[model samples]
Structure formats: structure tokens, C-alpha cells
Target: MIDKILNTRTILAVDDDPTNIHAVAGYLQPHGAKLLVANSGEKALEVLAQNIPDLIILDINMPGQSGIEVCRKIKQDTRLEQVPVLFLTGSVKDVSEAFAVGGVDYIVKPVRSEELLARVSTHIRLSQLVKSLDKANLLLESVNESLEMKVQERTLELVTVNKNLRIEIDERRRLQDKISYLSNYDFVTRMFNRNSMEQELKVVMETQSDADARSFLYYIDLDQFKIINDTCGHVAGDELLRQIAELLRGGFEFASICARMGGDEFAVLSQSLNLDDAIKRAHLIKDNIENHRFEWNEEVFKHSISMAVVEIDEGIDSVSHLLSIAERTCFESKRKGGGEVSIYNYSKDYIDKTQQQMKIIPLIHQAIEDNQFILYFQHICANNDSKLQKIEVLLRLQDESGKIKPPGHFIPVAERFHLITEIDKWVLKNTFKAISSLPENIIVSINLSGEFIIKSNAVELIRDLLLQHKVQPSRICFEITETSAISNIGATHRFMLELNETGCLFSLDDFGTGTSSYEYLKQLPVDFVKIDGMFVRDIENDEISRKMVESISGIARAKQIKVIAECVESEAALNIINNMGVDYYQGFVAHKPEPLMNLFTLVK
Candidate 1:
């Protein structure tokens, strides 16, 4: 049966003979396929250029371009390669030649309608199947690509989650460790608590016998700690305690046990040491405590540690006795102005000392109220010459008894009562008043406490004072320690710029004494760098100190700032500083701090 073909099938027939072309067209007309005819092979190639056909019918044994030539050309052209070709020929050799040029079939010259229609329909169905298979392959490729992308995204998400989980776990472990440490140790000092100390002490006692020699217990109470805490705030007091703990821990490596007993008290137990050796160790610890300077918020404080050492013997049965002996000795040290070390001797008479000195504090306060606070000026001179370039104003207090007390006597007490700011204000106002009265070119510098700088009104207060006195700001310098300037950089920078804009200069006092001196020097806007007294005092004999001064002096010169060598006590020290290119020197060798009235005579 010949199935009726649709217009979708397009067939092109090429023949040089007009009869052959007409016969093929007439036979395929009932199949409903669109037929295009060309009389020559050249004409067929031209027709192929205009339209793409699904099927081609070629007649061999024609003129010029033969059926084999047209078929070969059609198969070679990639655009026409998909079109199926059938050859119609009278000769068997011609039909074989047609098949060799990619023709699917060849029929005799008298063409049959049923056979032609069947072959054309079969090729059309095969072509449609090939196109459907190509589409399915493309769809599969798109699906594979989408699946790969989703897998990659999920892998990245899992990796990110794993990294976050590991970090969280590490943080949790660190937090747990910190919590355990805090629970078992003192937060301020990182030292064992009283309970830990007691447990260690029992173990120590069990291991020791009479043949092991006697052990000693020393209880340390920070003298004037209450005063420091009250005046400097609890933060400063805590810092002071922490520093003391560190110093004590470092100083006594042979001590069997050590712990912070509570508040400002600490206990140290030493084994296998005689009374003399123990006493010597206590003295060494005392010196380290008294000499060590603690910085709190840029303010430097020297603390006095009072020690009470008790020797434990076979006769002493109780730990409380040792604690009491140490406590009493500490009390005695406190009673005697609290800067010295004392030992507890059980054989000596116990001194029940109380109500012995209640009259001194009031007398001191009254003296300050009565305008008896004395000002002394110490000259800081140029190192290159013996010229007096600057003077450091020192405070002295005269009591009603006509006895003068140094700053060490009442400053701590005053600071405890939050009276230092008032004292500082008075100093500033009077110091400016004093400088206003000085010679035109002479510049006087005053040391400012950290508390003064922290005050919001500090810059304004200084500016107003200078304006009121009509004092040239260049002639008045404010000195701050390196520790102070670096502690609060933002506040310090604003204060420095504001005061510097008004021509008031800043001197970084004790410049090389701090850990952050270099950092502070870079960030602080200052006019002068004061070499600390420790370096200056030893510059004559200490090679390291001399080199440090020279290096710092050179740096200061490079920065276009003046350098002042403080505490120049000897001629040797003076010569060394002068050679180092130091701009100023201050010490007993230059001028001792004298009364303000006396400074006038000296300046002239």
C-alpha cells in the first residue's frame, strides 16, 4: 500500500532529459510531497542553494553534469549531506556508479510509482528519528550539568559548616580553661589562693623533720595600701597588688609556699633556711618592693612593703603563732612610717604600740591650708653648655612646727583623699604666676599628674590660666611621663594638639623609663624629651647608660625636639651629657631645688 505523503516531505529531482524529469514529477504528484525539478546537474546545485530538500532523485546518463557528479557534489556539501539521494538509470553500470556517490538506491529507467514512494517515505522516517535522538542527547547533557552544580554547592556549604564548628569548639575549650584558672587562683595576681596555700603548707610540713632544719614564715602587708586604694582608686590599688605579687614571686624562688592571704596581705613560707638567711631574704624582697615603681593609668607610684618574718622552731606548735608574730612585726613597721623592714623576735618584749602617733596628719593638712606649701625650682641645663635652659618645680610642705616635709611625706595621703587634683590646680596656677614673674626668656616646666590629664577641663584650665596671666605659652612647659602619654593616646593626642596650638609646649618626662617610650614618642606631640634620672645618674660610669642617652639624644635632635638630661649629679655625668648633645640638664650638679624666692636671686 502506498501511504499518502504530506507536504512536509520535500523532494528535488535532477535530470538533463525533460521526459525523465516529467515522468518522476507526475508519478510523485499523488503522494502529496512538494517536488522541485532541475534539467541539469548544474541547475540542481543552484536549486539546492535556494532551498533545503529532505530527499533527492537523480537521473544518470545525461549531458554535461552526470548523475554521479551531482550526487558526489551533494554528498560533499555539508548543508546537503543530510538529504537522501536515489538514482534512476537505464544502464546497470550507471546505477552502480550512482550508488558509489552516496546514493541509497538505483532503479531502471522506466520508474515504478509504488517503489519510488516507498523508498522516499522510509528515508523521511529515518531522518526524523535521528533528529529526535540528537535532542534527547542535548537534554541529558543539560540535566547532568545542573546535578554537578548542586553537588558542588552542597560540598562548599558542608566545608564552611565544619570550619565554623571547629572554631566554636576551640573557643569553648579556651573559655573552660580560663574559668578553671580563675576559680583556683587570685584574679589580680594569678597566684594561689589561701585554700591552695594551706593545702601546700600541710604537704610541706609532712615532708620535713627536725633534722631538716627550721622553716620561716613571712607575712607581707602593703603599708599605706588603704591610703593608695583610697587615693588612686581601686583599679590602681589592684594593679599595685598585682605588681607586688609578681615582684615577690620572682624574688623568692627558694620559698616553700606563697599565697595572697586576702586584700593587701600575702604569706610566704620558706624551709631549710636559718633566721639570718631568712631575714636577709626578707630584706631583699622589701627592697625590690619599695624600689619597684608601679604605673596605674600613667601615674607612677612607689609602694612601701612592710614585712614580718617568724622563725618556726620545734617548740612552736601552732601556725597561728607564726602568723601572729609576722602580723605584729608588720604592725611595728607600719608604725614607724612603713618604709623599713623589721623582724619578729619571740624572745624580745612585745611592744603594744597604739595611740602613739595621731597628731602628725592634722598638722600636715593645716600647713597646706595656711599657704605653707613651698615651691622649689631645680634647674635643667643645656648639656652642650652649662646654661640653665629649664627648671623643674618641686613641691614642699612646711608644718606648723616649722619643719618642712618633702613630697614623699604627704602627697600619697593627699592623693588618697582625691586632693591631688586640687593640689595640682594650685600648683599650675601658682607655677604660671611664678613663671610670669620670671625673666622673659626663662622657661619653667612643671610635672603634671595623670589625674590632671584625664580631667575633661585640663586643657581648658591651662589655657585660661595662661590667658589670664598674659604668660607666653612657650615659656611655660608641662611635663608628663612617658607612661602617662601612652596609656590614653586618643585623649592625650587631643590634649596635646589643643595645648600645642596655644604655644604651650609639652615635655615627655622620664622618657626612656617606660616599655612604650618609642611608641609614645612617635604618637605624642611634644617639645622636649627628658632622659630619665636612672640613665643620667649612671651615664658617667655605665657604658650602656651613656650609649642609651646618646642614642635618645640623637633621635630627639633628629625629630627637632630638645633633650634634657635629668639628675646630673656629678661633673663626670655632666661632661658625658654635654658631649651627647643633650640640650638641658637637671640635677644637684646643676642646681638643687631651692625656694621660689631663692630662685629669683639665682635667675638674676
Candidate 2:
């Protein structure tokens, strides 16, 4: 009489008597089912908090908290209520109490094994069927709501038409034409959207002659438009986009095809332009955009665009492939600064970097899942002190072949895909565990991304880790890049201040590479400013580098903030920075990064 439905299901049996619990377990174990036993009603609730079983078998009597009370609590919780409860009552009076407390069915104690198996099987089968139907209903409702919204929009448009016979006839034809126009063009800028552009590209590819030279696809992205959009309203942003669309159409020749792919992005297709001519054309567009200013509410704002140009050759098989290459190259150009251009020529170096960027996403997922990421620490020395008083932690990924990949190779790609948040969490958890085992006074610094800094929950996660690992806040330091701080000043300030209050230190890394005004520098409550490595690398030989170092040091000194010099590769560079009144030195001259475990053996 047993069914296969109960074979794989789990059942939790709760009772005060060991003999009755063993009886239920002995009967259920032979059926190829799992039985979890709880000694009392209180113990049953603890097990239920962590696991939801297909069925709960409860004994009504002989416990401090009765089985009826446990059933009542389970029914009150919507997540646990869907689970069927089967009660075992020794008396007929308790059978009515079981039904009142939301038990699906009851069997009297001194129970027969055959009846126990039959009731458990029936309830488990029904619970699964109900869950399946609930999922189906949710999916159907989503589809219905989407369809209803579309119908309502169409109905509203139909109601606005005139009533005259002649006018109504013309209105229907006009509406059809309007629909066709919208299908191809963006409503706001009146340029071709992504879908329409692909259809046109396909037509051109089919009709073009084989003898003709390759055309060019220019992917243009507006820079700093987000800042303007966020500061001003969306209405102003729309006006700016419309103006840019008109500028693009007017700047290019009539033969060239122009389109707006989406928000703050536009593209142009040019035919028969040589590399030199294309470069000049790209520069012209850049210069025109830089000079133009938009006026809104008596305020003026300027914007620039970054562009990538790729050849539309026979090798490109689809629109997506061409756009992806152009977009990647465009991103590289934008990295240099605003109004920059990059050409995708399939050169070996460009191809290698692009390929690495493409592969990094999946590799990051694998690294995190397999726990293959590791930490290395580099020593930093304070002024005139040769000891390794502080160390900065660095992260590296290990491949399956046991080769370690540097952060430079993967960090940029990880940042682009928003995977940095997960990577940072992994680093914080592991690093805190490592730091806890080191000397109580040893300081370790970890880098955090801007995206993580902006999250409201990031501080809570860090605080919990610190408490769990038993690491002192003063022994840890957080390093953030200068540009990241300036990008979201309010959030960055709050993140730094909150942690600083807990005795954790903050450092402004890559200083002097961002804006030179130095006003925001005072607002950020950081303990140290690490001079950018580019300037520190040749401080002894280069006069400009020395002056830049001196100027940055003097400002930090004025604010009572310590300064750390990076890239101190040689004795001359180290001597120069030391004389410049820098408080700390970090580079090969001090000590290179090594695995935390290899550096020393600590009590774990």
C-alpha cells in the first residue's frame, strides 16, 4: 500500500518519549525516507527554523509545550503553513484539538504502522501538487498584466481621433504611418533606434559590391552626461540629447547614416574613408562638441563624446559582433579621458587585451566559486623607520593550472561587470580572518571599490565581519582611489566617517591624479594621502615630478594629514621622497608583495 511519493520526502517526528520517537523512525526508515527526530516541542521549533520538511508528525501529549501549540505557531508562519502536519493523539479529545490547530489529519497513538505510512504518503503528494499550481498561477498573472497595459495604451490613442467620416478615414491612415515611423525611429531624438539600425545594416551588407573598400562604423558615447542629467532634471537631459542628435546629423556628410542607439549614445556609418581621413573627421567631431554649450534655467553646461571606429569588412558576420568590437574599443578610448578616439584594427596587442577582457567575466565566477582567490601583502615603512610597520593587502586569482594572475590583468574587467562587490566581500572575509591571527599591533590595508562604498549595507557587513573575526578596528585600514571618492562625495564621506569612528583608518590612494583643486580633499576624513606612482617613479631625475611631489606633500602637511609615496623603486627615488617630508614609503625599494602565509607563521 506504500507509494513512491513518500520515498524521497523528509519527515520530522516530534515527541517527548524516546520509545515512541524510535517507533516512528523504525517504521519510516525502511521505506527509503528520511526521518528527523526532535525530543520535545521546544526542540522541534529549533529544527523547523532551519529546515522545512514535507510533513511534520507530532505527538499531542506528554510535553512541556504541547504539540497543539507547535502546530498553531507553524500555521501562523505563511512560509511553514504550506507544509502538511500529521498529528498522533492518544485520546479522542486530543483529535478535535489537533484539527482546531491546523493539523491536516490525525492518527491515534499506539498507532498501527500501516495507517501511519498511508497518511504520510497522501499528504506529501498533495503538498507538492499545490506548490506546482501556485508557481503556474504567478507566471500566468505576469503575462496577463503585461498584455492589459498594452491594450489600454492602444485604446487611449484610438479615443483621441476625430468623429467626421472624411477625417476618421484620414486619421486611420495617419495612425498607421505614425506606427511605422515609430517602429524605425526613436521618438525623442527622431533617429534610428537599435532595431531599425540593424535592419538597415543587413540591407547594406546584402547589396554592397565585393570590389568596394570597407566602410567605417563610428560608435559615439556622450561623456559626463550622467552628472549633468542627475544635477539638472530629465527634461533638460532630453533637450541635450535632441540637440546632440541634430549636431551629429549636421556635422557629417548627407551620405553618412546617423542614428541614436539609446540614451546618450549615437553612431555614424561612413563609406570609403581612409585611416587618416577618419582620424581627422573624429577630431573635428570632438572639437565641435567641446565648444558647444547648452543653456538651461540660466545655467550653461558642456559635454564631450568618446568614439570608436571599426571597419565594416567582410570578416564581420553580424551587426552585434561589429557593435561589440566598436563598443569595447570605445570604452578603451574613454578611459584616456573625455573626447578621445580609438580605432579597432585587429592589431595583436589590441586583440590580446580585448580577448582578455572578454574572458575575465567567466573566470571571475569560477575563481569565486572555487575559492581560488588569494591575498599578498606589501610592506610600507614610515619616515626614517626601516621596519615594516604597515602592509597593504593585494588580491590575485589562481588558474586551474596553478598560475597566478595579477590584479592589473583582471581588476578592470571585474570592475566593468560589477563583480568587484563580490570580490571585495571575499577579500574582506578572508583578510579579516588572516589579520586576526597576526600580531595585535600589525596594520593591514584593503582596497574597496566605489560601488561597494555607495551601498548602505556595506558598512553593516564590514562591522559584522570585524566582530566575528575578533579583529581590532585600529589594526585595519581601507584604501579608496581619489576618483572614486570624487564620483560620489556624499556616500564616500559617510562611509569613511563611520568607519573612522570605529578606529579604522582610511587612505586616499592615487592622489593628485584626479582634480587639482584640492578642495574636496579637505572634506574627506582620511589619515594618509598616497602620492600617485606616476609622479613618484622618477622624482629624482624629473624636475616636474619633484615639484609635484613637493606641492602635494606641503598641502597634506598643512592639513595634518600624512603622505605616502608610491613606486619608490630605487635608492635615489627613496631618498628624494624622504627629504620631501613624506611620512611613508611603498614600493619595491621597501618590500615586494608576498603571500601572507609565506611571510610568517601565525597562531590561527
Please provide TM-scores, in order, for all candidate models, with all chains considered together: 0.42, 0.55
Lowest-sum lDDT 10-residue window in model 2: 157-166
Error of 2 at 204 (Å): 3.3
List candidate 2 segments past 4 Å from native. Answer: 1-192, 212-260, 264-310, 328-356, 381-389, 415-419, 481-490, 510-524, 528-590, 599-604
> What residue pairs clash in candidate 1, if any at all?
231-416, 380-585, 381-584, 381-585, 382-583
Clashing pairs in 2: none
**Cα-based lDDT for every prediction:** 0.73, 0.80
